[model samples]
Target chain A: MLEAISDWLQSTWLSHAFISQGLWAWPMSESLHFMGLCLLVGSVGLIDLRMLGMARGISVAALHKLVPFGVGGYLVNVLTGSLFVIGDADQYIFNDAFRVKMLFMLIAGLNVLFFYSSAFQKTKLLGPDDSMPLNVKIMAGVSLTCWIVIISAGRLITFYRP
Target chain B: MEALFIWIETSPLSLWVRGESGWHMAFPIIIVFHALGMGFLVGVALAINGRVLGLAPQVPLGKLRQFLPVAMLALVVNVISGILLLIGYPTKALTNPVFYIKLLCIALALWNLRWFSYSVLTNPIYDHGVLPQKTRQLATASIVLWASAIIAGRLLAYTYNNMMSI
Candidate 1:
């Protein structure tokens, strides 16, 4: 069951060390989390906006160069987020907000997948100022909405604690 | 100042912000706004700083200016939501030294944003991504100041001496 996994995660050395780091640990991780969020949003959101036809005269190929930063940010969040759950598994596993947040993250991930697989070829070929096709724009919208919901759900986690 | 804190803390709107009739919606929603705004504002700033430091050179620096408006919009949203949250717990925030540090960092960060806007973003000279030395330095400072602001803001919850009219 989920409880067993939570127990096992908490028993791990990483979680033990994380929790033992005293009061500042949580805030420090949170600060890092916020920074990582900036990186992800800044890079990924830029691409989305470009695909949505907001920042014209910028080629998708050029803006896509920032993908590494977004990936880096995503990794940072995953690691820090794991620490949160590992350090206090019960805080997240049974939490509806956390569940919702995870769902949003999954959707965002899938949205990106679908884009690169289907839309990226056509969109990337478009000129600097050319508008994206309607389908591509829909994906861009979905990406933005998913991220917004993910953020809101994250904020709601503490409040929605069960 | 103490009286002002007390008054702000007791206002009907402030009470609602803290939460009302078990709604508990206002505070968390405001915080979400704060988070979303921070993501865009700080995130876009980071991207710009990266470009100045030679991260993404193909994108014309001037073309990047279009994104600044979104960051500005984020700033506006945060300012409004931040005020709402402050009104909710004036004593908790105002009485804290870290709060002032956060404010200072934000002010300086905004100053850096303005400098970057005029000096680098608006200047067609750097359009090809070849930034001046000073512009690069300012971009570095922007990153540091923003990180400091976020750190100071995060630390506020732990560093505050008084939660309310103690």
Candidate 2:
């Protein structure tokens, strides 16, 4: 089923442009991807660290404002990452590394949902001296680990390409 | 310079990284760390700079300094990984002007951070009040510098003329 979808997607005009005129496309997407990665890590990661008990003095609510930047970064990455998938469908669709990356991203997304639903309100009200709940700490750890894994797996994609 | 490149490239460490040995795994692992480090360094820097530029006004600038250590840790990771990468392909990086541009941008960004720390962060007024014009300027420059550094670093992969000497 996945192969069929990839085959269909590969035949599209968008995919053709990504492959034929991809000399500049790949690098441009890659650069933007890096930038977006930085943005996401900087804002979201920092807040996660804070929740994990680092930089406790900074108000969690204030740091929450930076989450939008991270969201923006995520948007940029999604667009570029899709272009990559559309451009060389086989390179990612069947690749183990890409699969792992997607898994990590899924885990991250679920973790975010859990955070907002379970811990966001309580955590945001935390004072400098307030102790973080174990669940929030766990969420932060999961977030950091997921992002690091995502990056490592993304890099490994080239090495493990099918 | 050619002789130097050959000497460095032929070194055991470099050979191992470039060769088809188990140690070849080190090359990509180090690159992975490099990317991770870049994300931490640039990401934290952007956060701090964003705050200074009035993105998160409620957060105290002084408190943000706590993350400096984390950023520094990332910088150290990058430097070590960067050196290893250069060792693996000295001819590739050293021969390219983009490499130097990337380094210069990193240097400037670090310098800008230092200036901001000394001038703005240390000032008690900036803790809760508005940031001064000069500090905002430094923050703006820092964002530009780090972005340029990232772009230049990314370009090095495509712009290099030589991959290895040996």
The candidate that wins on lDDT is 1
- lDDT tens digits, residue span A129-154, model 2: 56688988899999999999999999
DockQ of each: 0.87, 0.84
Question: Candidate 1: misplaced stretches above 4 Å?
Answer: none
Error of 2 at A54 (Å): 0.6
Worst 10 residues of 1 chain A by lDDT: A119-128
Model 2 — TM-score against the truth? 0.96
lDDT of 2 at B120: 74
Residue B134, candidate 2: how far off, in angstroms?
2.5
Name the DockQ score for candidate 1: 0.87
Clashing pairs in 2: A42-B43
| Residue A145 error, candidate 1, Å | 0.9
Top candidate when judged by DockQ against the true structure: 1
- For candidate 2, lDDT tens digit of each residue in B51-95? 888998888888888888888999999999899888889999999
* TM per prediction: 0.97, 0.96
